[model samples]
Every structure is written in structure tokens, then in C-alpha cells.
Target chain A: MSMPKGSNIGQFVVIEEGVKLGENVTIGHHTVILKDTVIGDNVTIGCNCVVGVRKSRNQNMRISNSSLDPLVIQANCKIGNHVSIYSGTTIAQDVFIADHASIRENVEVGPGTIIGRGAIIELNTKIGHDCTIQTLAYVTGDTTIEDHVFIGPCVSMSNDKYMGAREYTLKGPYIQEGAKIGNNATLLPGITIGSSAVVGAGSVVTKDVADFKTVVGSPAKDIRYLVSKEVSEHDTTT
Target chain B: MSMPKGSNIGQFVVIEEGVKLGENVTIGHHTVILKDTVIGDNVTIGCNCVVGVRKSRNQNMRISNSSLDPLVIQANCKIGNHVSIYSGTTIAQDVFIADHASIRENVEVGPGTIIGRGAIIELNTKIGHDCTIQTLAYVTGDTTIEDHVFIGPCVSMSNDKYMGAREYTLKGPYIQEGAKIGNNATLLPGITIGSSAVVGAGSVVTKDVADFKTVVGSPAKDIRYLVSKEVSEHDTTT
Candidate 1:
């Protein structure tokens, strides 16, 4: 274990062998960093977090996760208490992950994303920069989200349309840049949400949305085309 | 600390002073049991859990939670890893609380309930017997839930109608017996979900639902009355 200059680690923290911590790192009590994890400068992790966590697959899970890469957290990230970040993940700089959030393996979180409390980012997902995934949201595996997207509280995206009843290929939703998914919305598998689209609260998106279109209701239908590029201010606060 | 006969405690477990554990209790690694917590016989708690957690109020909050009762867990309950159950809570016997769940203060979870993984049960809620609150569901504060209710994954209930912008009393939904709220459903504040009512997936419920009625869509409308008492088998699996 190598801790660089100005690092302050709390008691009962377990930094395993081959772990490297950069300058000005602050880790709280009972945090566990697994082997070969790298933390950049000015990172602050709160209590009871388990970084670089090893993966354990259930027997019925069909997804192949046999091989995994080491974890990497870039500079100036703020991780809250009771977070569980797995191995094979790379979190970019200036991200704020709130308390009790769980990020699964093989995930990529871009810079300055705000993952709200108790949000679950599943394996093999790619999240772009400056996004907000709010509380209790479930970003399922194999999803791709572009930059500046805002996902409201309890938004659920499904990667498998079959719901694990039979063998099927998994393909999650592809959300383009600046899209806003409202609270309690559900995105079906393999759909594409176009750029700057606005999905209303509690809408169930079943198909592709065009750029700048506003959709609402279940089997979400187009309400109007957005005249401006800016996402709704109400969306970010939800 | 008093541990009854046949209790098995793992390494790094912190059982604080005045805590009591009954016979055949199993506590996993690095779990923290705060002062004066009572765990009954044959209970099992998994790794990294925090039981009997003290509450901290946010500076801007209007609710008063100055007084709290001690935490109690009855026999034969199974608590999963990374769970957080706060002070003033009572979890009844045969309840199964899955991993990453957070139960707040002043809550009551009745017998044979199943709280799914990553579920958040907020403060002052009363959950009755044989209930199932599924994965990623958000049960907001000040709610009253009756027996044999089923809340699906990512279901969100609101307690404040104004979203905290104004001064208002917080009152969550009152869900009666045998109600089934489908996946990603959103229940607005202070509404009564009547007995055995079925709320469909992705619905945004804004009003009172009558007993055994089925409602769907945004600003949810009544579809039909359920003919039977049995909740759909599909609802339990979602």
C-alpha cells in the first residue's frame, strides 16, 4: 500500500496491497479498498464504503462477467457514506456520488455526474458527464447515457424485455445528450431517447423519441417539439 | 453487552454497551450495533449493517424528531448486508430485509414482511404484516400501510405535495389491506389507496382509488374492478 503526501485515512480502514492513494486523499472509517485500486488526488470517501469490490454472480444470471479490470477513481470526487463501488469501474473527476449509492462492475461514470442517494448503477453501463441520476433510480446494465442528461427520482430502465423468463440478448436504452427523464418513468429495453427530449413524470417510454420532442403518458406519445435547447429546471431538482 | 447462549459473532463486530442479543443469534463481520438495541433469538444479520442508528436532522427541516424509542428486532428475522435500521424502529418476526435497504427512525415493520434490496423505508411509516416492498421502492415518510400489501420495484410515494417549496403538513399515502402497487408507479401525497386495489405499472396516481379497483395511466384513471382477491402473480415477480 502506498499513500502519497497529505493523505488522511481514518481508523479501521482496510487498504489492501497494491493500492495507491494520491495526494490529499481523505478516507473515513471502516472503508475497504481492494487490491490494485488507484485513487487520484483530492478524493474524499465517507464511512463504510467498499471500493474496488469483487463481483459475485448468481447462478441464474446469464451475463458473462468472468474477467474484470481494476478500479480507478480520478481526482476531486466526493463519495458519500455506505457506498459500494465495484472493481472494473472508472469514475471520472469532480463527480459527486451521494450516500448509499451502488455502482456495479464494468461501469464508466464520466466527470461531474451527481448520482443521488440510493441510486443503483448496474454493471456494463456507461454514463456521460454532467448528469444527474436522482434518488432510487435504477440504471440497468448495458445502458448508454450521454452528457448533460437528467434522470429524476425512481426512474427505471430495463435492459431485458423478457424479464429473465427466457434466453434473450440484453440491450438497454440509449439516451442521447441533454435528455430529461422525469420522476417514476420507465424506459423499456432497446429504445433510443433522442437528444434534448423531455419525458414527462410517470411516463412509460416504449419506443424511440425524436430530438427535442416532449413525450408524456404511458406508451409515451409526443406532446410537442421543444423550441429551446435547455432542459427543464424542474427536472434537476426532482 | 449481554449475548445469550449459542450466539455467533464475527470479527470486527461492534456490539455496544447495553445491547442485548438472544440465543442462536448470528452477527456478521464489521456490523455495528448501537447502544440498547434488542435482538431476539434465532435472528441473523449480515455484514456491515448499522442497527439502532441515531438520527440527525437537517438544518432546514421542519419536522420534529427530537424524541425516539429504542430499536427492537423480534426473533427469526433475516437482515442482509449493508442494511441501516435506525433508532425507534421495531421489526417483527420472520421479516426478511434484503441487502442495501435503509429503514428510518420511528418506523414499524410487521411480521413476515419482505423488504427488497435497495429499498428505502422513510421515517414514521407503519408497514403491516405479510407485506412485500420490492427492490428500489421508495416508501415515503408518514405513511400507513396495512396487511398483505405488495409494492413493486421503483415505486415512489410522496409525502409533501408542494415538494418542500412551501409550508405544509407531510402525509404519505394510506395504503389499505391487500393493495398491489405495480412497478414504477407514483402515488401522490395523502391519497388513500383502498383495500385490494391494483395500481398498474407506470401509473401516476393522483386521487383516491376505490377498493378492488384497477387503475392505470398518468393521472391514473380507473380501468376496472378486480374480480378476485388474489394479487396478480406477475406483480410479485416484478
Candidate 2:
């Protein structure tokens, strides 16, 4: 392990073999950084965090078990207390992961994203830059979220429609750029939320949304088409 | 601090002054037990837990600041890893609080309850015996949940109807015994869910539900009245 010259580490931190830290990295008490992990310059990790945790296999699930790459945390990221980031994940520069959040293996989080408190990001997900996933939201496995998307608090997304009752392919929602999903909304499996679309609070979306559309209610229907690109951009992405 | 006979505490554990542990307790690595906490016989607490945390008041919220009593964990309780339990709370016997769960101050959880992984129980809630609050559920402040109740995953409950827009009384839902709220359901403020009532998955509950009724959909309406107490009991409570 090679520690940077200006790195500041708190008491009881465990930096394992083959781990690398860049300049001015700050880590709080009781944090454990596993072997082969890479942290870029000026990263801040809070107390009791476990970085580069290996993904556990379940006997009931038949997911593939390929050799995973080491975790990578880019420069200027701030990870809060009690956060858990698994191995094979890549967190880009300037991201903020709030307290008690969990990010699973094989995930990629782009630059300048904010993962809110207690949110759960499942395995194999990819989130683009400048996104905001608010508190307690569950972004399920295999999802792709584009840049500047705002996902409200407690939003739930599913990847399996059969929910383990039958053997089915796992495919989560594909949310396009600048879309906004409101609080407590449920997005069913394999749905595509188009660019600049707005999903209303507590809605249960069952179909694909069109670009510049606003949808509300269960089996979410299009309430109105956003009149112009400027109007849609002002209402959602901003 | 007084450790009981046959107590098994892991490395890097911090047991503060005035904390008391009973017979055969097992505490995992890096767990912190604050002052004046009392743990009874045969309890098992997992790694990286913060037990007996004091509540932090926000400058924006006008809530009373009374002196809190010490935390109490009764016999045979199982608390999982990364859990955060606040002071002035009492967890009764045989309770199972899963990993990453957060329980706030002045809460009361009765015997044989199961608080699932990533569940959030806000302050001043009272949950009765033999209940099951499932994963990612958000039980807001000042709520009351009676015995044998089942709250499903990602179920969200609100206490303030105004949602910070205006001043109003904060009163969460009063869920009676054996009520089952399904996955992704949203319970609005101040509503009463009657005994053995069933709120279906993804439902938005706005009004009070009658006893033995089954409600579904947004602005949930009664789908059917359960024929008898035996039928409702068999379907929900059991």
C-alpha cells in the first residue's frame, strides 16, 4: 500500500495491501479500505465505511460469478458515514454519497452526482453525470440513468416483473436525460422514461413515456405534452 | 461499564461508561454502545452499529427538547450490522432489526417484531408486538402501529400534510392491529387504518379504511369487505 504525502487518516482505519491513495485523501475513524482499491486525489470518506466490499452470492439466485475488478473512487468525491461501496464499482469525480447509502458491485456512478441519505443503489447500474437520486430511493439492478435526471425521495424501481415467481431476464428502467420522477413513484420493469419527461408523485408507471411529456396516476397516462424544449428544460432539469 | 459473564465483545468495540450488559451477550466488531444503555440476556448485536445515539434537533423545525431516558434492549434481541438506534428507545424481547435499519429517539418497539433491512423508523413512533415492518419502509414520526401489523417494502407514510409549505399539526397514521400495507403504498397524513384492513401494492391511501376492508389503487377505495373476522385474520395477521 502507498499512502499519499498529504493524506489524513483517522484512528482505527484499516488500509489493506495493494490499496492506493492519491494526494490529500481524508478518511475518518473505523473505515476499512480493501485490497487493490484505488482512490484519487482529495477524496473524503466518513466513519465506519467499508469500501471495496465483495458481493455475496445467494443460493436461490442464479446470477453469473465472473472475476470482478477492483473498486475505483475518483477525485474530490465525498462519501458520508456508514456508506458501503462494493468492489468492481467506479465512482467518478465530485460525487456526493450521503450517509447510510449503499452501492453494490459492478456499478458506475458518474461525476457530480448526489446519492441521498439511506438510498440503495443495486448491482450493475450506471448513472450519468450531475444526477440527483434523493433519500431512500431504490434504484434496482441493471438500470441506466442519464445526465441531470432528478429522482425524488422513496422512488422504487424494479428489474424483475415476475419477482422470482418464474425464470425471467432482469432488465431495469432506462431513464433518459433530464427526466424527473417524483416522490414515492413506482416504475415497473424494463420501462423507458424519455428525455425531459415528468412523472407525478405516487404514480405507478406501467408503460414507456414520450419525450417532453408529463404523466400522472397509476398506469401513468400522459397528462400533457411539454409545449417547448425550453419549457421542459425549465420545469425538469433545472 | 459492566460487562456480564460470558459476554463476547469483538475487537475495536467501544462500551461507554454506565452501560450495562447482561448474560451471554455478543457484540460484533467496531460497535459502539453509549452511556446508560441497558442490554439484557442473550442479545446479539452486529458490526458497526451505533446504539444509544442522541437525537439532533434542526433549527428549522420547532420540536420540543426534553431530556431523554436511556436506551433499553431487552433479552434475546438480534440487531444487525450498520444499524443506528437512538437514545430514549426501548426494544422488547426477541426483536429482529435487520442490517442498515435506523431507529430514532423515543420509539417503542414491542416483542417479537421484525424491522427489515434499510427500514427507517422516525422518532416518537409506537409499534406493538409481533409486527413486521418490511425493507425500505418509511414510518414517519408520531405514528402508532398496533400488534401483528405488516408494512411492506418502500411503503411511505407522511405526518405533515402541508409538507413544509405551511404550519400544521404533525400527526402520522394510526394503523390498528393486523393491518397489512403492501409494497410501494403511500399513506397520507392523519389517516386511521382499521384492524385487519389491507392496502394493496402501489396504492395511495387518502381516507380512513374500514375494518376488514381491502383497498387498492390510487386514492384507494374499498375493493371488498372481508367476509368475516376469520377470513381477514387468515389472510393478513397469520
Candidate 3:
């Protein structure tokens, strides 16, 4: 078979056939790009990042069949080292995926979003444009996050209340536009954070948060409105 | 400034001065090794794994400082692609870190251990030798896992009972040698798992588990002695 063409692929870099790559797409050494993967122009994929497809195995049990769809990465995207964009993931244009982030199967990330380092975006999640998902946050399946939202470090969002062994359905949660979720907060499934809402750090959110409201404590109760002072201070520091 | 000698960095890889790399080391493309990190000999660092670290910002708030000390990776280790071994982490010899695993600061992984793919070992935890930490598990801080332990996928271990914003003194919870923890199990702080103990899948363990016993369900109760038949069957399938 003829050698696949790229700018530079270091030793042990595996790229399957039918994978389309745009100009100036630099893939680091030992990176694996599976079949049918499409990468856009000026994209920099860091070393050791696994793109495209994989099978799901559970302790000797083949829990799910192997994935088939190609990963589609848009133009001008900067993917950091060690980022695993799993099968059936579609990353939109101008997205910045930081180091060590895990984007699981069938997840769609909108354009201009920044997936922070070590962030975990679970399967079947839809993240909107211009969102900033911070480091080490966990976004579970069937969740929808709107545009310009900010999720803090170690934020945990759940999909199941009474988690079980077999497959069960829990209603998907929604995080509206411009919302800010604090560090180490847990949001139960089927909840909604309205536009511009703020969930405080370490809070356990059980119910819906109203638009522009600020919630705090366990089973999060609305404390007050989000002050402009806090927002301004946050902007200056960043 | 002159680059540090013996730094086996690949093409398109950048390493700031003062970063030390041992013999026969391979660094993948577009991977950056920041200052003050030390990597040992015969270490296979996979593509896109970020060594050393950076701080994270949320909504302009300097949430938690995720800064770690210079990372030290020991000899004969196999680190998978896209794994993030953060600062202040010391990985002992003969360790296997799978793809997409995130090991945060101040964690010490003993020799001959296997950290599965997508597992997150949080700060200040001590994992013993010859242990198997499964995929997608979240292990919080100050926990002690003894040698020959087996931790299954999606297991959650916390440091606090009433988890809140305040900083509480975290004592080490003990997992004795040869213990086996099942998938999606939750372990509360200050609890102990005795030697050769077994925790079933999807259980919320609120108390201590006795040695050589098998525990299941919420507030994990001892069901019976762990049979060799079950263990052998489980081993073959995984």
C-alpha cells in the first residue's frame, strides 16, 4: 500500500486510509488516526492524541459494538497533547481543545468552544458555541449546554438519580446561555440553569435555577441575583 | 539560552530549559515539556500526553490553583496517549498508565500498578504496588490503596461526608492488600476495606468492609465470603 501523505508523522504514527486531511495539518508522533477521520486546515494535533473510532469493552464483556463513524474536526482548531476525541465526535471550527481532555463518543461541540484540560465530556452530549468548559469537569450524557457558558473545575453533572446496573433513561439537563457553574458543584439530571444563572461552588443542585438568579448550598436555593461586581472582578483576573 | 542536554525531544516538540529526560525516552510531536520536570529511563510517553502543568481560570475567578510540582516519572513505565500526569505526581517503576487517564497533583503511584484508561486519581492519594485501578474511576484525595488491590471502572471515592466549600482535614482511608472494588461503587471517607475484601458493582459503601468478605448494595453489607470461582470468572472475561 502507498504511504499516506502528511506534513510529518513520527515513528509508530498510524493513519488509516480514507482519512482526509487539510493543508498544514501537523500530527505528532505516535498519534493514531483511525479510518474515515476528517481533519481541517491549520489544525495542530498534539502527540499521543487518539482520534477516530474505538470499541467499548467491559471486563471481558463486549458491552457495546465498535463505533464506525469518522471523527470530523473543523479548521483552525488547536488540540492539546493527550486529548482523546473518541469515535462519533464532531468538533466544530475554531475550537480549542486543551490538554488531556476526554471527548467521548457521539458528542458534538459547537464552534469557538474551549474544552479545558482534563475535562470529561461524556457520550451523546451537545455543547453550544463559545462555551468554556473548565479543567477536570464532568459533563455526563444527554446534556445540552448553551452558548457562552462557563463550567468551573471539577464540576460534576449527572444523568441518573438512582443509578443502576442496566440501561435506564434519565431526562437530560440544560444549562442556558451565559450561565456559570462553580467548582466541584453537582447538578442532578433533568434540571435547568436559566440564562445568566450562577451556581455556587460545592453546591448540590437538585432543582431548576431561574434566569439571572444565583443559587447556593445543597439542593440549591436561590440566594440572590448575580452581582455585576463579581462578574467584573472575574473578568479582570482572567 | 542553551537547551538541556539528554533531553530526547522529538521534532516539532518544545521543551523549556531545566526539564530532564532519562535514557531511551520518546516524546511525541507537538508535545511540550515545561520546566522543572524529570522523566526516567525506558519510559514510553504516548502521544498528546501533557507532562507538567498549568493553572485553570473560571469566569475570571481564580478558582482553585491547579498548579503541581515538577512531575517525576520513574523507569520502565508505559504511559498511554493523551494521559495527563500532572505536577507533583511521582509514578514508580513498572507502572502502566492507560490512555485518557488524568492523575492530578501530589499523588504517588507505587510500582507495578495499572491505572486504566480515563481514570482520574485526584490529589494526595497513595496507591500501592501491583494494583489495578480501572477506567473512569474518580478517586479523591488522601486515600490509601494497598498493594494487589483492584479498583473497577467508574468507582467514586470521596474525602468528605458532608461535602462543602470549607476545607476539611482529610484523613487517609485504607484499602487493604488484595481488595477488589467493583464498578461505579462509591466509598465514603474514613472507611477501611480489609485484606482480600470484595465490593460489588453499583454499591454505595458507607462503612467498613471486613477482610475476605464480599459486600454489596447501598451502605454495603457483607453478603458472604468471596469465592475463588467468581474471581476467576471475572478475571477471564475482563
Q: Judge candidate 1 at residue B159 and give its lDDT.
A: 74
DockQ value of candidate 2 = 0.19
How well is each residue in A119-187 modelled by candidate 3, as lDDT tens digits? 878777899999999987778777999999999987776665433233667545799999999986767
Candidate 2, residue B79: Cα displacement in angstroms equals 3.7
Q: Any idea what lDDT model 2 has?
A: 0.85
Superposed Cα deviation of residue A228, candidate 3 (Å): 20
TM-score against native, each model: 0.68, 0.68, 0.56
Clashing pairs in 2: none
Roughly what TM-score does model 2 have, to 2 decimal places?
0.68
Q: What does the interface RMSD come to for each candidate?
A: 3.8, 4.0, 7.5
| TM-score preference between candidates 2 and 3, better one | 2
Fnat scores for every prediction:
0.27, 0.23, 0.12
DockQ of each: 0.19, 0.19, 0.09
**What TM value does the first chain of each candidate achieve?**
0.91, 0.91, 0.86
Judge candidate 3 at residue A152 and give its lDDT. Answer: 91
lDDT of 3 at B183: 54
Please write out the lDDT profile of model 3 over residues B88-125, one tens digit for every residue: 77899889886778887778899988887788887778
